[model samples]
Target chain A: MDQPRVGLFVTCLVDLFRPVIGFSAVALLERAGCQVEVPTDQTCCGQPAYNAGDLKNSRSIAQSVIRAFEDFDYIVAPSGSCAGMLRAHYPDLFKDDPEWSPRANHLAQRTHELISFLVDIRGMASVENVGFEAQATYHDSCSGLRELGVKAQPRRLLATVEGLDLNELPGAETCCGFGGTFCIKYPDISNRMVADKTADITATGADLLLAGDLGCLMNMAGKLKREGSTTQARHVAEVLAGMTEGPAIGEPEKAPGT
Target chain B: MKPQSHLFKENAKKALNDANLARALNNMKAGFQDKRRATIAKLPEFQDLRDQARDLKNHTLENLDFYLSRFEDRVTEKGGHVHWARTPAEAREAVLEICRSVDAKTVTKGKSMVTEEIGLNDFLIESGLTPIETDLGEYIIQLRHELPSHIIAPAIHLNKEDVAETFRENHTQLDPNRRLDQVQDFTDEARAILRQKFQSADVGITGANFLIAETGSTVIVTNEGNGDLTQVLPKVHIVVASIEKTIPTLEDSATILRVLARSATGQEYSTYTTFSTGPRRPGDLDGPEQFHVVILDNGRSALLGTEAQDTLRCIRCGACMNHCPVYGSVGGHAYGWVVPGPIGAALDPGLIGLEEAHDLPNASTFCGKCAEVCPMKIPLPKIMHHWRVKEHEAKLSPPRFRQGLAMWAWFARRPRLYRLGANAAIGMLGRLGAKRGRFAKLPLAGGWTAHRDLPAPSRGTFQQQWARHKRSQAPSSS
Candidate 1:
């Protein structure tokens, strides 16, 4: 079997807020025997516009993504929401446009979320034990768990990691409430939801929280930090790729004297 | 019963801060969710039944006019009346007229969202008739002068303590010092009070879970048996239901019924599944003397060809709300209308105008749990998204939100410019919060920073790193 050509859709959040997750994803994909390419023409999965009901711009942006990554044998993203947008919703966006609908469907059919791509597509049974030890729990981002069926794949890979203790978070399937623009639009409700989520995460007594989506990770990390919780948060890819060397997401940068 | 949906945010804020309500909501969260999961796990054909249910509703809705006329003919043949109401006011008026004709002094009521939707209780009271709620949950909330926060569990927003408080105030005839500590005591007291109302009332009003056109039967499922008593004990039985409630056959209703209770209270079947075809027959032992169904369109017919058509397929199982994280957090009243939660977010905009119910749809996280749990396979999130689209197109959303989206869209379309701008923004954020990986506050992001710190970006964007990596890998190319 020849190496599959993979284009990484480093989602807007990963590209802007946490670039390490993207690099971690590349490392994981390469280890799984894929030649990875980060398309320069890629900007976003256009979810912000699509979710905000700006269909025109969502379509245009999706078109650019489609054009950029169409040639790759597979397209994978580190975030479920963005991957879901590309895999599940892109075709729906162009359902009425005769010219673009087939193209959109073609792109959508080839797209996969990172963990699922590694486990399901590559037939990679277990991640190498990175000796990264932590009591960690995984948050199933809504899009990944429900839309893309990404529940067991991440857990399957995590099982192989040597020193990681995986404690299940209560109400793990519930939304962390980042919900893209929902966090900004209805901050109070979003806050209440994330507060509930952090409480659940804390109750698990896990020192670290990991999730596939950067948006949810960022939201949970932000809430945990505000609540002065000691629990650290990071992308699951970072741990699996053995790249948890830097400060965890939302951890403070150390001053020169310190 | 007034459409307070526009005040959803205020209501939600109050709901979140209410400790008693939060406790009540938390209790409901586990029971409903766990029960549904257990029941679903037991039934292997549940998914197939859901698909069958969805298809049945879709078929009935597509030929709704035909099914409705067929239902009317069947009901009329069975010596019953079907009153068509174009609006809530008309439905209320029709119910009032029926009560007036009966010279009814009091009406015993079963739980009916449609009646609450039309403000039937207030209308009946103003028309000089007393309407008594017989369902225990309904009775509790009615005594407290509060609308039901939940469809199936009407008093889910109230704790047992709230009920005890309400009972002490409203049931003045009962001994104040008597033991009212247990849940059973509340039920026994409600039954004792409602038993009298049932015997004396001239009319009974109930909501139909499903209206079968084939048998001219209106079905109501209840655990308390209030719906059965409400219909059978009165001279006149009136059922208020939306037009979308009609199904083609009894078999179809049976198929839907399988999923309904499992999705609702997680019972394989409610304790009582009463089917009333019409007024008492000549040979009948016990039943009402008159049967009238107030079939309401209430803007539902207009939704037929639109993106919202799937909403009409809803079985009112409350599964969507039960599984919703937002509804679980704030409880149902925060939605501020007769209908609440995910189903309400999608359906209410059509029933009430979108402008009034605009905030309802936006309240969701698009978690897809509502649709995942929905018995009818209704695409609730997709319907909500449609409402959002409608709100955006009509310029009903805030001007600032629209402008922000527009500006972002403008930058998002040009990748080169987006990369350049995003790279600069990342660098600025990284330096600003270098000492702390998160910001306690930031300009133009108070919504985010109010309750949580915003995580600062890394030193550079992914594109920059990719560019650097490519240059390093191919030394000769640079």
Candidate 2:
């Protein structure tokens, strides 16, 4: 059979803040024996609008997303938050529309989060030749864990990477408080949540912090860096795809001598 | 009591600065979350029970009128009176009329959120009657003249010292310097004070966990047996419940009760699950002489058949708040309403108005944790979003937030425009913070920068690099 076609939905945060995650997603998809395509017509999964209670704009944006990636065998996103929007919420966005409802439902059926697709759909149990010799902890982003059921898939794959010690962070399933616009809307509450999360991440004493979504990664990484901690945060895909040669998120390029 | 939900942001800020609240919230997180996890893990049939509970609520809600009428008929046949109240004023008046009929001066109350919703104690006070709270948590908050910050744990925002202080202030006749450090000390003092109110009160007002339509009974679950004393010892027992609390049968109530305590306080079953069929019967000696159930609609009936209809299934288990990270951080008072947390964010707008409670809905991170822990599967975040949609359509959202969202949505619809904007923003930000890799303070991002640094863009946008990478590989691959 021909290789399954996968459309990579690079979330907005990953596209701007960290492109390596996008690259890592392509590499992982290719390794899983799927033909990956990046549809430039896609901008976002319309979560901001939908979450902000602006359904008019949310529906309009969701239509463009459906049109861009409808023909692919599966539409995959590196972030569970965005993938959840595509797979679980898009149909609800157009539920009342006779014209767009079926189209939205069609796209929802094909969308999958990156790691879950690799592990569950492609049956890729382990990485071929990747190793990260460091103590690491993984945060289960709320949407990915509760919405798309992307819990064990990332862990199962991470276990196969050579020399990687996965320490389970206490309250690992809690939100990192970078809830799209939530961090900005209610900064006081959001700050307390992220502060608590960073303390837990630091308590693990793991040198590396990993999560599937770049938004959560950026939030945790930013908090960790601001607190003057040495724990580096990166996308789970970066480690799985052997793309750790680059500096971790929020890290400057290494000096020539060092 | 008057619905200060409009001040949620201010309340949240105050709650954040409170060290005592922080200590109490931390303890709650460690205590409630671990207990619920362990309790649910022990029950293999917990998930199946949740499904059944959810479906049963859905059926009852779909036929709410039928079940409510059946409940009224059964109560009347059993010599109990049923009072329908469409507004808070009407509900308050009905309770006052019943009290007047009994010539009651003192009223003892079991833990009831609906009474809190109607602001009953204050109303009773205004009408020249004394109302005492029997539940330990409720009595403690009552002594402090404060609203319940939590549903089941009314005084959860207060630490032991705070309770000790409150008991000292209100129980002035008792020894002020007595030992009150231990948990049992507080309970003992509260029990001693409340036992007199329970026996002397002429009317007892209690909230029903479930109002059975088939058996014409009202069920109350309490750990301290306060509800039983509050209902049985008084001459007149008044069961005040919202319209959505009606259940079709006793078995349905049992199924939901199984999850209620386990989800709320992590108990297998509350210490006392008392069911009162009606007022004192022919052979009854201890129960109340007159029984009255006040069913308040307030604004709940309007919620039926709407997107928020699922919220009616809420059993007031407080599980959603216990597991909620926002509630964990800020505690319940930050919500500035009778009900707080995820369920409050979803249901308060319907109870109160959307405009007044606007901040409650948007304050969430949309974490989905509340719904995950909710036994009835209310889809809390989704309903909160529904309130948001209404707020947006009504133009009730802040002008700046609305404009920002509108601008972003406009650009997002045009992919090419969005990419160009993203490219320019990323390019500039990437160059600006190339040295340190993040921004400690940035313009227009003060909210995020105030708490944590903002990570700078690594490089050009992904689409730009992906285009270049494909161009670089095209010559070799083809």
Candidate 3:
């Protein structure tokens, strides 16, 4: 079989806050023997605009996105959320633009959230079991589990990791309630939910709280720090790709001078 | 008043983002909810009661036509009129006819979602009759010219400050300086304002929680006692409800109530549980002189045999709404329906037609909290999935979405092509994003990447890594 020409849609979370995941994606892809290319002009999948009801901006961005990767053999994301958004909301954005439908359809078909891309498409039932392990609990990010069908991909990938002890948290799928702007908008309610999620994570006694999306991790980690909990938060990609020896996933470091 | 169904998001956004509104919602987390829980906890037989209640409701639903007729029989026997309304228009007409028959100028109403469903207050006012909502929450929302966001807590989105503002704007005569104070103070003030309306009203209208067939009685549960006043004070008391509410016996209804308070507010029962079979009895001191029960079908019967038929199993406990993360964030207004929560998600498609409400089903995170809290154990997420399937089948989803899924479905079936396709994806992404190691925008991905980052596809898909592991596995095993 010919080596596949792959395009990684490294999510903004990894690019801006968690760069190790992006490097992990590249290293992992190289290990898999696929030619990896990061398209330079790529921006975002316009989820904030789409979710915020600014369809015009969303369409404008989607057009740019479609143009950038339209030539790719396949488009993959480390994020189940970004991949889901690309696959799910892209067509809706271009529904009225008659010429763009096929292009959008082609892109959506090739798009994959990393783990789902692994388990469902690649049939990767096992992965390099590098001795990087932890007793960690997994969180099902809303878009990942529901929209992108990433429920078992992360689990399967994690299972293949040599020393990783995967434990189940009760109510694993409940939103940490960090719905992007929803956290800032409903802080009290969001705080309550995040605290509940933190309590669940702490209850597991898992050294690491692992998830696919950084949005939930950041929101949860912030709450944990504010509440002074010792549990560390990491992304599922970081875990599966064996790249967790980094700053607590997404939080920016305290500067030299403030 | 403003045709709220059309501008749902604007209203919901206003409600959701408002810190004042969130503060107002805090009362709900504690007050009605805590009280309800306390009452339910005090009752040991609550689960047994819920089981009986579910069975009772099942029986009523199965024999709805019979129980409804039986209710009609008892109403007629008590010298009250029974109006069978197959639609909202018919129900509205039945109400207008009664108003015109009595030349009613003023109407006092208990908290009733059915009346809201038919736009009764708006219709009555349009027909030139004055209608007032006696339930404090309903009254607050009415004054705000808004729809109730909750079945039980209609003004749940409004804080006490908002209420104080509304009261100050509407009822100016009272010394407005008195802190607008406690809930009791607010209720007392609201009572004084509504007492005269109740006493002088030409008619009273209430929604029936349950209609008992054996005794031909209509039951209403309330915490504030306003439903009783709305039923008792006027010259005529008109009961507006859908056909699904009737049961064969009061004992059956009591069973349902066991779960109702607990699931809704965590209460064993509301403070006031009134059963008004008809108008005032001859010996009754204070009750309406006439009674009328108006049963509205309103597209519910069409749902009877459909896949959505199990949706009727909902008992309006509000637990689904209370536990829904989406509803908790967006509030009920965004659903653009009277019932807005998990129950609202499933029921709205059937009631309003799938096209208008396709967004409702898709709005859920599918956290399954609603199904968990649902006393009936309704599989809300599965039902939502069914709606998505139906949406896809109807070609209601954009053609591009279909083409995308259809293509994925294609590759998904063919394992080799899928693996090649997958490897090709991660390889290309890794190459393009080699510099920054992440692409913020991609051809079609910018729709999402524009707002959020797209973490570059990692080096080879997990399948390639698995292959290496397999080759390595032979060495380890040997």
Candidate 4:
């Protein structure tokens, strides 16, 4: 059988902030016996516009995304927010456009967030964990957990990791306050919320924090770094795909003399 | 009540810094949320009940005029007077007229959010009638001269110490040195103080949890029996309810009641689920002689056929706020309205003009937890999004935000320009923070950097890297 063609929707956050997550997703997809193609025309899932209520531009961006990745057997994104944007919101975005609504729905049906795709769609029992030895806790991104129902898939895969001791953050399913534009719009409240989140994360006494969405990971990593906490943060894919050699997100480079 | 929703950001900051409110909110965050989870877990049929409740509310909303008329008719037939109020002012006047007709000196309230919405208490006070709050939380807040932060838990923003202080200040008859340390002590104090008010009040005004058209009944669920005493003790009983509270049948009300208490306080049933139908019948042992139902539309009719129609299904269980992270962080005062949390975020804008309550919708992170836990399954985030669109269209959002979105959308629509822009931005960001791996501050992103650092970008965009990798691997793969 031909390998099912998957178009990697490398979300804008991952594209700009952390490309390794995108590569890690590609590696995991390939390892699961799937052929992945990167669609360069993919800029963003238009969540920023869509979320900000700019429907006109959201629709245009949705149309571009549909035109870019519609031919692939599956459209997969590393971030739940972006994937959820495609799978859940894209249909609604084009609800009025007779020409685009059906196209949006077609693409939505084929879209999946990366981990859920591996566990639910690909039916991969477990991935070969590349021996990431750390006490790591997973923060469930709000979009992924609530929007995509991605609670157990990542954990199910993580259970097979050779040396990963998974300590569940108390409010693991609670939001990390990286609500796209929300963090900027309501920074004070967002900061308080992330402070609560970081407190919960530190309470677990885990050395590392992991989440599926780069937006959330970046947000958490930034908070952890700002507070001068030693706990590192990374995308769940990097650990699962054995690409953990590089410094964790937001970790400063060592001085040349040092 | 004048809306302070425009000051939501400032209010939220103040709430975050309030240590007392933080303690109260933190307690609520765990107690209510966990108990709700536990109770829902015990009931397998909860989800089915939710669906039924949603459908029932949807059906009633669709035929709202029919159900409302039926309710009014049944109420009138059963020796009750029904007054229709198109707005909050009208509702206030209707209540005042009822009180004046009875020559009421004191009006006792039974935790009515609708009354709060209509500013009924203050209106009555201004009209020269004293209003007393019978519910303990309401009584505490009334004494404090503050608003009810949480809907179900009115004084939820107040700690026990705050309540003790409030009681010491208000109840001058009681000894100041009395021990008011325990939760029960606070309740007992409120119970003692409000008991006199409930008895002395000439008229009682209560909000309806559900107005049953089948039986012409106004239902209120409370942990304390204050709602019953407030209505039964008073000579004139007035039920102040919004129009959307009307349900088709008693059975539908029962189905909704099954989820209401469980969702609100995590109890299988509240201590009191009082269903009052019209005035007392002839030869009744103990009941009010006059029963008045003031049905307030107050801008709800405008949302009947709109995308936000789902908001009308809200049972006001407050499970949404109980689970809302934003609400948890800021408590309810920051919302600066009768209703707070996700429900307020969506509904307040519709009730008050969007211009006044615009900030409420944008305050959310669109986390979807509120919608997830809502027994009505009202798509709260979706409703909030609708308001956002309206705000954007009206140019009510900050001009900088609009221009930023416009600029980003311009590039987003064009892939080539987007990639080029992304490439240039990523290169600059990567080089700027290459050593630190993050920026402590950045131009035009103070909102982000004010709280946390922004992680620096990689050297190149993912698309560029993928393209180069693909080019290098083409011959090897073949």
- The numbered model that scores best in lDDT is 2
Q: Which stretches of candidate 2 lie over 4 Å from their true place?
A: A255-258, B474-478
Candidate 4, residues B1-478: lDDT per residue as tens digits?
Answer: 8999988989999988898889999999999999999999999999999999999999999999999999989999999999999989999999999999989999888998998888887888888999998888888888888889989999888887788888888889999889999999988888887888888989998999999998999999998999999999999999999999999999998899999989999999999999999888988998899999999998999988988788999989999999999999999999988888999999999988899999999988999999999999999999999999998889899998889989999998999998888999888988888788899999988999988988887667787777777878741110
* DockQ by candidate, in order: 0.62, 0.66, 0.06, 0.64
For each candidate, give its TM-score against the true structure: 0.98, 0.98, 0.70, 0.98
| Model 2 residue A30 CA deviation in Å | 0.9
Per-residue lDDT of candidate 2, residues A164-210 (tens digit): 99999999999989899899899888889999999999999999999
For model 3, residues B70-92, the per-residue Cα lDDT tens digits are: 88898889878899998789999
Across A1-258, the per-residue lDDT of candidate 4 in tens digits comes to 369999999988988888888889999999888998888788889999988888889988998999999999999998899999999999998888899989999999999999999999998778773788999999999998988999999999998999999999999989988899999888989999999999999999999999999999888889998998999999999989888766689876555212
lDDT of each: 0.91, 0.91, 0.73, 0.90
lDDT tens per residue, model 1, A1-258: 479999999999999988888888988999999999998888888888888777888999999999999999999999889999999899999999999999999999999999999999999899876767899999999999999999999999888888999999999999998999999998988998999999999999999999999999989999999999999999999889887777788886554322
A132-222 per-residue lDDT for model 3 (tens digits) = 6688898898877767667877887788888889999976877887765445333544555676688889999987888888778867766
Residue B158 lDDT, candidate 1, scale 0-100:
82
> What RMSD does each model have against the real structure?
2.0, 1.9, 10.4, 2.0
TM-score of chain A of 4: 0.97
CA lDDT of B257 in candidate 3? 75
